[model samples]
Target: MSNAADLRAKSTDQLNEQLLDLKKEQFNLRFQKASGQLENTARVRQVRREIASVKTILGERSRTA
Candidate 1:
């Protein structure tokens, strides 16, 4: 999980990359849950929140620019 300040400091390209990676992870987590192979159930919530945070930060940057 990344802090807001840290995320805000990164370039747009980096944030986009991170967002892509998070989406991929989210998909995998969902797959695991469906297959009953998910160990850390809490990770799904964590990833969702992180995805939201990254998106929020990206929105802020876009509005300011």
Candidate 2:
């Protein structure tokens, strides 16, 4: 998990790409859970929080700009 400081250091475009990747992983995790193929259940929550963090950082940048 990346901390706020690390996320803040990233450019907005990099953050956006990261957010998109996390969203895709979230979707795949959901499918894996449904198919009973998911072993790392905790990852779902981690990804969710990561997505939120990226969005929060993006929002902060937009507000500041």
Candidate 3:
């Protein structure tokens, strides 16, 4: 997991790309859970939080821009 400071330091374009990748991962995790193939139950929570964090950061940047 990346720290808020690290995410804030990244450029908007980079952050957007990372956000896209994270969303893809979130989708896969959901599928894994539905199929009963998910091994790390904790990962679902982690991904959700990470997605939230990235969105929050993006919002903050946009508001300040």
Candidate 4:
């Protein structure tokens, strides 16, 4: 998984786009799990961590500006 500090370096709009993309990926991962097609279960954790990273960035930005 990519680090939160790296993810937080992007602009707000970029962050939003990334967050959206990640959510889509997370959905797909969940679908795969349901279908018994998922090979890497750790992916779900990675997606979750990324979501948390995005939210952390958003929160920090809001408090600063």
Candidate 5:
């Protein structure tokens, strides 16, 4: 997971890519949980937070621009 500072340093395009990947991972994590194969359950929370962080950063940029 990326910290807010790191995410803020990335370009908007890079951030969008990161967000997409995080969403994909989130989906896989949900699938794993449904199948009872999820090992690191905490990862689901981390991914969710990371997605939020990326969205927040992107929103900030968009609003300011």
Candidate 6:
């Protein structure tokens, strides 16, 4: 995973793309949880953090723009 600085350095478009990917992964994780096939429950927390990271970068970029 990239650091906050690396994330912040990404352009808005890149951040958006990353956010979309993260969201898709989050959805898959949720589906696995529902199906009782999720092996690592900790993945939920990690993905949540990744989502938040992308959001933070996007929000910061928007404010600056």
lDDT of 4 by residue, 1-65 (tens): 76876887788999999999999999999999999999999989989988988988899999999
lDDT of 5 by residue, 1-65 (tens): 67888888999999999999999999999999999999999999999999999999999999999
By lDDT, the best candidate is: 2
With a 3 Å backbone cut-off (N, CA, C), the pairs that clash in candidate 5 are: none
Q: Write candidate 3's Cα lDDT for 1-65 as tens digits.
A: 99999998999899899989989998999999999999999988998888898999999988999
How would you encode candidate 1's per-residue C-alpha lDDT over 1-65 as one tens digit per residue? 78999998999999999999999999999999999999999999999999999999999988998
By the TM-score metric, which is better: model 1 or model 4? Answer: 1
Number of residue pairs clashing in candidate 2, backbone atoms closer than 3 angstroms, sequence gap of 3 or more or interchain: 0
Q: What is candidate 1's local distance difference test score?
A: 0.96
Whole-model lDDT values for every prediction: 0.96, 0.98, 0.92, 0.91, 0.95, 0.87
- How well is each residue in 1-65 modelled by candidate 6, as lDDT tens digits? 77898987888888889889889988999999999999989988988998898898787767987
Error of 6 at 4 (Å): 0.1
lDDT for each residue of candidate 2 in 1-65, tens digit (9 for 90 to 100): 99999999999999999999999999999999999999999999999999999999999999999
Looking at candidate 5, the ten consecutive residues that score lowest on lDDT are 1-10
> CA lDDT of 39 in candidate 2?
100
Model 2's lDDT to the true fold? 0.98
Off by over 4 Å in 3: none
* Error at 18, model 3, angstroms: 0.8
Off by over 4 Å in 4: none
TM-score of each: 0.97, 0.97, 0.95, 0.90, 0.97, 0.89
What lDDT does candidate 2 reach at residue 62?
99
Clashing pairs in 4: none
Model 4, residue 50: C-alpha shift (Å) = 0.8
Cand. 2 TM to true fold: 0.97
RMSD to the hidden true structure, all candidates: 0.5, 0.5, 0.7, 1.0, 0.5, 1.0
